[model samples]
Target chain A: MDVQEAEQPVKKAALSKKESKLSTLTRELKKGKHYYILMAPYMIIFTMFTVVPVVVSFFLSFFSFNMLELPKFVGWENYARLFLSDDIFMISLKNTLLFAAITGPVSYIACFIFAWIINELTPKVRAFMTVIFYAPSISGNVFFIWLIIFSGDTYGYLNGFLMQTGFLLEPIQWLRDEQYVLWVVILVQLWLSLGTSFLAFIAGLQTIDRSLIEAGAMDGIKNRWQELWFITLPSMKPQLLFGAVLQITMAFAVADISMALAGFPSVNYAAHTVVTHLIDYGTIRFEMGYASAIATILFILMVSTNLLVQKLIRGVGT
Target chain B: MALFQHRRIIKKRLNRSIPVTIMLFAFLMLFGMFMAIPLVYAINNAFKPLDELFIFPPRFFVRNPTLENFFDLVAVMGDSWVPLSRYFANTIIITVFGTVGHIIFASMAAYPLAKYKFPGSRVIFSIVVLSLMFSPHVTAIPNYIVMSQLGWIDTHASLIIPAMAFPLGLFLMKQFMEQLPDAMLEAAKIDGASEYRIFWTIVMPNVKPAWLTLLILQFPVLWGTNGGDFVYSEELKTLNYALEQITLGGIARAGVGAAVALILMIVPITLFVISQSKVIQTMSTSGMKD
Candidate 1:
């Protein structure tokens, strides 16, 4: 033991030097040669599939380049036009932001409430209930659901029901009205994401230690809602942050819901999120440059919000 | 002693009928039915004949069911403007390959992010997570242009390859891997195992729950419908996509489209049910451990 202790200092010093050198050497190979080797396939595919298009789209969003014409650079003209003159684009952004801002918090609360119920049940009942609830996230064809709710025809189910119930004297033009179309969209969006967000919340709720709740109870936190507020919410921080991002992304992109329920960009563009607008100006119109600018704006917003969310997660992790 | 006996009886009663547990189950059952009723109605309608479908009230079941729609679906399958089978094949190829490929590739990539302390790993991980927040629709035009440039437009490659770059799988796998102990890797390394060997031997065996969760999440996202019926080309269509094309754009295709939707939903639902047990097992292990 005495000999081992005496040699430990010399051996540790030598080992540190050797370790540092070897790590540097491994780092160089991994980054310079091996790293690229590992990452090359994804990078190549993503570049081919994602990056190149983004670059090309930056060009397409400019100019009056329809599908037939060669894309001509129109500088900041498309964006300037959108702000200065495009009533539809302005309306789309406003509606999109409003929907996202409102829905994010609402869903956050709904998911928590849903999760609380699931986790409170017996394991067997919880699993059974979980599968039952999650079925919707995959079940309905988006178009089918939209058609059922907003068939636009007088005989449409919702329209027929409303008329029969005497709530409306005449069948309403459900999808066409710019005022009501947005609500139909909001309803569908909320309905569709119930499964994924609820599942995520359940996962979060399951992670919380029972002991903490017991501790809270012992500390005279006798109220059930108080126990939840002080104990349950803080424990589920990782999921809280994750669910926030999921909600933000879902609410912002709401493009397909718009397309399905109200057609592309929606009537008078009331429901066209910035994304649908990007697709219109860039893909259909071939204004690649302008699309890129819009995309970059979206990318910036998404990433910054995501980073802010990650910070919240890090605080919880620590 | 009398007080203690009384308390025991009360405790047993409370245990059997815990208010929290009752509330949770009731809430779950209510919402579960709410979410499931539409699909149930769709399936019930699929087997019903046309006369039974639009009853004055609503028929939960049909007295005389027929495979007439299935027969019609089959007979009129290719006879339709777009071939149903061709469309089904296209969607299947996209969904199956995309889900499987994502699982394989994401698992591979996640190994380094979760276990390796290599430089720039944090940056790479952050980028992947941040990408999750970006709406794919914004990239629709860019992706379309890129696909056109590659001559991949309307091909399954347009759907499959682009969707394969999904970051959700990687993030899920990374989070799952973090739960594994470093001691296992250290012990394996002490035994002279290479990093790859450690990952495969030790790490791979433990991540079954994460994989199932990812598979469940990704398949529908990638292969799900995009609100159009009929791709305008008979050759490039999918069964559901073809069904979607029903119209003078409205009431005529409602029943037929509902039939197709019922059939289309079966595959994912079956896959989910088959894997759900495995998912439960893995999750239970981790949940109980934690």
Candidate 2:
């Protein structure tokens, strides 16, 4: 009888603790009730489009569904098919990784370097240079000029130049040839790559305190590189990280240029990417389940890379 | 004044090495030409007559520039089932609504996320950051479903509403807003100002650069929207889609295609140029913290 009485008191004490926790939560909620109201509209839309879509994609990856019929349970069959039976998937995965590996770092470095150099110029020249550097990225649909340049006939600029200079016996099929298609696309991508990251770097450079550079000079920093390494780079870590994420996302999503320049399903899938593969199944073939699996894999790839890069960026200049 | 003079001297002395300077200039000029030549060529192509366009060993510059292509574009556009003006109106409607709506909602959402730590704040922010890593390509299939279920498909709302929720704008706006001094908000609160009043009058005014940055960023995106999967009606199509269709009209329309490209790019480019300084100023504050 004494043991039962003691246990009852302990249970009552635990219940009171739970009640307090619930009360505190409600109190906090009440305190920030206005914040919740402010956030509601954006949160609702964000939830519907961005958050819900991602969650749905993740869930749908496990089922087989076309638009017309009910989704059927498929277990891991779609994923297994992607890894095991699908040769095109392997090709796409390889191409996407290769494309991202090349474009991501190259474009990122190029953005920073151009911004850094442009910052050294006088303001009038700086603005002019900024406009010049930023022009191609904003120039919509003009990358088709690259198509004209790399055209197979001698009339194409590249072919005409090479032939005129006697560097080639015949005009090369730049976009059609498997060996050259990826490289051509890569070149064009680099040209168009100095985009948001470039602007961000410029802004980052501008935001750096002039006093810091003076302080570094006082501390006996020898040259521009030292100034950049010790003072400038560390000050703009946030911008650098921001640029990295943008570049990584863009690098992985290289479908538009490839589709336009190299032709979709380029010469034997030479320039095929994960997104292109996704579009193939998702939009054209209506293999929603398979496409969802592709998307989920891509999502995992991008997020993991971003996380890894974020860690590396945090270690910068330490 | 003396300190400023001394700083200038120090900067001059610590200037980049001569060899590095030369190398950098060379690279700058090289890339500058590479970037500018295509655009210059496109501009030239737009003014080229038909004969010049098809000339062998394609001419870098048009021997004779004319407004023929522009005239042709007008004529061709007149033949379309939907008027070119309708496409323009559609684009204007979409771009204005999408960009403005994004700035307002994102700023509203960003205020609380930036300044206060309420329930689910960290979780909500983490989700926003996570959304940034992946491209929208992943979300297309599911977003289409969501749009249709909401009865938003085939409507301008499909494009405008989703655009309002673009995570990067919120991410950047929040980052910028965090830099706003808490003391200012606290003082406002002490004055008995409501949180809504604080957000609208004080916070919004102080964060002009951030919203301007959002405007510049979102403007180009919305301006260049092709209304990919969500929009399908001919009347509902954007200007970019219309121009793209014109360009796809085959070999005979090559001159018109170049003209179309020029027209397609001109508006956003002009917007960037006009707002370049303000946008950069805003972007200066657009840094994310760890």
Error of 2 at B113 (Å): 1.0
| Model 2 lDDT per residue over A1-318, tens place | 999998998999999999999999999999999999999999999999888888999999999999889999999999999999999999999999999999999999999999988876667777877888887787767888898899998988999999989999899999999999999988999898888779889999988887888778888998888888899899999889989999999999989999999988789999999999999999999999999999999999999999999999989877
On a 0 to 1 TM-score scale, where does candidate 2 land against the true structure? 0.94
* Model-by-model DockQ, in order: 0.31, 0.58
Report the lDDT tens digits of candidate 2 across residue range B224-288. Answer: 77887878899999888877786676678888878878877777777778778877776676666
lDDT of 1 by residue, A157-258 (tens): 677677778897776787899779888888777767765556667876776786786677668775557767788877766667667777778777777667
What tens-digit string does per-residue lDDT give for candidate 1 at B1-290? 12122254243222223465456556666777766766776787678777676664444556688776677677656776656677777777777888887776777777777766666677877766666787676566666556667777656666677666776667777777777899988998799997667766777788888788778778876556542221335576655556667533455555576678786776666666767655433332221111
Give model 2's clash tally: 0
Q: Which one wins on DockQ?
A: 2
True contacts kept of each: 0.33, 0.74
lDDT values for all models: 0.67, 0.88
